[model samples]
Target: MALPERNNEGFLENAWQWDKATAEVIAAESGISLTDDHWEIIGLLREFYKQHEMSPPSNRLFVKAVKEILGEDKGNSIYLMQLFPGTPAKTACRIAGLPRPTNCL
Candidate 1:
């Protein structure tokens, strides 16, 4: 099943309201600058809308994604980690602006 399209304006009025501290934690752990470039994959994942109806495997996928987008010769996990640390899944998902993950339990 697909996730309901969130195209409605103001639908996010109560979505992922990250405070300054939470945003900072996500940034510090993920190292991904909370910028447009960092948001590309998140957008892509949002569109993915897996059968499970949730965000994709973020931390695990970040490495492979970097390699695919930036080039396999250049997308190393250690480096990506420096850029997006923690579980990578957490960092990626949060930055992607998706909901917090479930398996993160």
Candidate 2:
């Protein structure tokens, strides 16, 4: 299937075009092979976007949101960093086919 258009930074131009296949392609570009753990966060991010219509604006907020939902065991920076290297929120939102976090750089 043809992939959806993305911005220069690799985020989907239209989040509505996202799907599992699209996510796999995007994640592969980052050398990530999605596991159940990855899917857990991805699912959360998708639901978050559905509910809030935006991604967490920064890594700290992202961690806090995760901690609120999944608790500290899986929500800490170290764990998220291991699952998604380099600015976890940015990398994760990209892979989740969500818009870039407004304050992430």
Would you give me the overall lDDT of model 1? Answer: 0.50
lDDT of 2 by residue, 1-105 (tens): 678999999999998899999988888989999999999999999999999999999999999999999999999999999999999999999999999999999
* TM-score, one value per model: 0.46, 0.97
lDDT at position 6, candidate 2: 92
Q: Lowest lDDT 10-mer window, candidate 2?
A: 1-10
Query: Which 10-residue span in candidate 1 carries the lowest summed lDDT?
Result: 6-15
TM-score of 2: 0.97
Per lDDT, the best of the predicted structures is 2
